[model samples]
Target: MPAESEFTVTPYSVDGNVDYEQLLNQFGADKLTADQRKRFPDPTHPLVRREVFYAERNLDPFLAAANSGDDHALVTGRGPSGPMHIGHIFPFYFARYLQRAAGTTVYIPFSDDEKYLLKDQSIESISDHTRENLRDLLAVGFDPKRTRIVVDSADADVVYPVASALGKEITQATVDATYGDPENVGLSFYPAVQATHLLLPQLVEGRQPTLVPIAVDQDPHVRVCRDVAGKERHDVEKPGALLSKFLPSLDGPGKMSSSDDTPSILLSDDRETIREKIQTHAYSGGQTSVAKHREQGGNPDVDVAYLLLYYFFEKDDQRVQRLAQEYRDGSLLTGELKQLAAATIADFLEGHQQRREQLGPLHTELQPYRLTDEERRQALQTIGYPDDSLARQDSE
Candidate 1:
């Protein structure tokens, strides 16, 4: 067993006062130094650009820990409310990239069980939704062998132990530090399940580094996981985290929701549907009049079409710079920009659907169960088996 000293935790900071301009300037100066821009180009808009900067900054510690082979873990899951949208792709993709670069183990837990409460959807609906969601996630191009994907319902035996153990470690102080209240049972319990997923990999055979790629809004959950892991209640090293910014809704800067049935595009939408939706519903930050837009140029800051391009399209930096210039100079009309975005998005979705179809079924075979009789025995031995009734039965 690896000693507790094998894991290292590093602190991170984000400059509270650093505005968009300073961020852009820093990005420009540091552009030649790092290969991140080659993989994920600098976003044209200031808001997204700043977000990208912050995401990379936050990931530095996790990246370092991963290189050191410090038994870190990455945790991410979907709400299973409906078909995943394009926005759902960011966190997993970021995780895949970092995991591949650092040779870390990645665990993607299907939070389908949590969807029962969060989405207000029926338990019966969860099975089909979870299967379809897993299919979609597999299609996103993560390595099946390297990643361990588990559905919360069918895998209850595996989940329950980790969840119960972590739950006992949650003090009122820790709960308040996370959700700002110990009364929210749902919040507290959910974090326990999530942390269980993170540390579960360490309890299994061939332990590896765990790093969770998630959005900033989900930071509270990761914080709880880190705290629980650090307490060593689960007898495994604490997992590190990498956080991304939430992908904004097509309607604007507000939440990109599947329940709202708003303008956001789903992964299942066909080419024609995608085109129609973008042309009709996609918000444009340009002027109502062409004349005024030509004189003043469109604001890329709030333009939905431009933001989509930054997220999806891969191009030379010069091309992005030119697009920003053309949009601002009124040379690129809102209609044309929307058409371009729709085309780019349609291509991306079509490719994903094809990949998903090739992934075949979403079953236990793809992501093998983490705990077996032998594996459980080994984990208990590593942690000096607990004295609880359930532990005695499992041990027997």
Candidate 2:
């Protein structure tokens, strides 16, 4: 392990003009009290929260769904637009933590081909990108066997049922209710596939509690899943949902998007790139001038450095606390804080790279696809896939 000191560093004088409190309020961090806020206080918001529901609408249904006592299966799908970044791992880590605590099973899907449609990338690139993304996900410490990984384009049989079931469940009324105006067939189809993935484990022999640790932006899909889960239970019997919040980009509250083309720190980023990005770009909620900062104190609520520390730095709680205190008192400068954050991030990516290297070729080969022919055939017939050879191949 690299010593903590080996990480990159940058220095900046604080300017008091930044409205840290307003920034936090805008991002919904205002819900926390001063002391409670201190635990996370900035960009590093906690992944887990007491109220784990899908959206602001329909709280009662989600609560009722939670009470169903059916085992929860965590589901997440990657677009495979590009390399997996630190932001990509946030929900995965949360799911891993939840699975360990609750002993629940997880289902991860590589929606590589979906990116081709959504991002306008070519379909030809999705297969290789999905494979690469899967390796990155495995390196994040997800167990291959315990977690079922599937590619959307490849597993037509497994995917078709869920898609068909979802289409049946999502009437025009439901589609209009959830997605105002349903303009695209792909929108309905994709949500159905996601809903099917959510319910698949429940149909399997060992039913488990299913939860999807995802960013809040993906809640729409989960809402669709919830709707389908209810219909499936009545029609076919299946499990429901559990959702998590999205991790913000290092730049701040917006989604950590791969297509944006702005510099994002990927798991594959080298030490120098990680350091430069953190030092140069990671948003800081600190002071503009060092003199004013010392007089007025640092704003812990919006500081990017503090946020990264809360999420990434596992040890040195006391040191982190001390940094917060100094920052709040305006004794610590934003430049020094940025340096610390860059270093911490560099260390984390380095460690991740080492673990990723250990995953090897067999791990890639072992990632779950759709069911075999016999299994796919049975499932397809059950779900009503016609005699499509590609679909048959998926069952095989």
Candidate 3:
């Protein structure tokens, strides 16, 4: 771990000991206050309740819309760079909770184009990953009527035109400042595309408060979109953000990454694989010797096994507290905690995998979730293409 103040966090990478509170200051986001939490529909998701999702910018309008049963939506996206992992699924599940609780419309965008530009991969490779990723996303069980999944390349009819309009508002200097200099022109243009993703819900459904729930590292993307929405030309409210800490990696405390030497628990891991991985690779907070651990109480705060449960797997608050206490006093052995987390995580994945298996052909299952022709037209029209504005003129 780097020194307390030595960390670096950006939309692309995170390193060292991240001071999350300091990040809020650096990013100009506020803490997710108690008053704001109170306004959420009953049975708030543990991600929010446990402060796993701990910060915000412009959250109230969305909350007001949620409470009053008015129009509201959430945009949570995926980058199909590789197979989905445990860390990759948090925001999707969190969004599902909001959808169930408040009837919130959900828009999921797969930035395959961004991944292609950023990674040394081909379009075919990205497409393969996109199809697999769509399966995992489908397992989360969002309502088809209220949810729309947009793939940047596949949906470019709407995405490209909308992004082109917003691109005029976002300068190269702004993109350079927010994300650093572009490695490629596609990346330079991606911030505008990202703004298109965030604002698309309102663009299609008419102006409504939209909330983007994402890890704190992604806040810059939201800030860029908010800046564009503030411009006079776009008829949209700035999307709000609900930011969260990086999910802890299996090896230790820093952000989880597939690039890390320690293998991540993929969404496809079976019960045995999950157990073996947890028992072998999970970082321990206990003493070197069982006797010493019993004598001197372990620190649950840094334990990967315990943190996984606290972060998502264990929903029963009292049980989690009890386990933490037991672990602190050495009543809960580190192996026992690992066993418990492996089982809990396996249970969650069991259902997810079952749903995935039950799903029909990928293209067929994905159909209902794709934007309808009318929706694509509405989105394009909102960005100034009325009835395919140019095509109509050309035909005449």
lDDT of 1 by residue, 257-279 (tens): 56565667888999999999888
Query: Of the candidates numbered 1 and 3, which has the greater lDDT value?
Result: 3
Candidate 3: regions farther than 4 A off:
389-396
Off-target runs (Cα >4 Å) in candidate 1 are: 1-61, 65-72, 180-187, 205-209, 232-235, 364-396
Q: Write the per-residue lDDT of candidate 3 for residues 313-383, one digit (tens) a residue.
A: 89999999999999999988898999999999999999999999999999999999999989999998899
Q: Of the candidates numbered 1 and 3, which has the greater TM-score value?
A: 3
Best-first order by lDDT? 3, 1, 2
Q: Put down candidate 2 lDDT per residue, 71-178, tens digits, no spaces.
A: 545666677877788777766766666455444456677776456656656776776778788777777676554566666777765776657755777776766665
CA RMSD, predictions in order: 8.8, 9.4, 1.5
What C-alpha lDDT do the candidate models reach, one value each?
0.63, 0.59, 0.93
| Highest-scoring model, TM-score | 3
TM-score of model 2 vs. true structure:
0.74
- The local lDDT score (0 to 100) that residue 370 gets in candidate 1 is 41
* Cα-based lDDT at residue 68, candidate 3: 94
The TM-score, computed over Cα atoms with residue i paired to residue i, of candidate 1 is 0.78
What's the TM-score of every candidate structure?
0.78, 0.74, 0.98
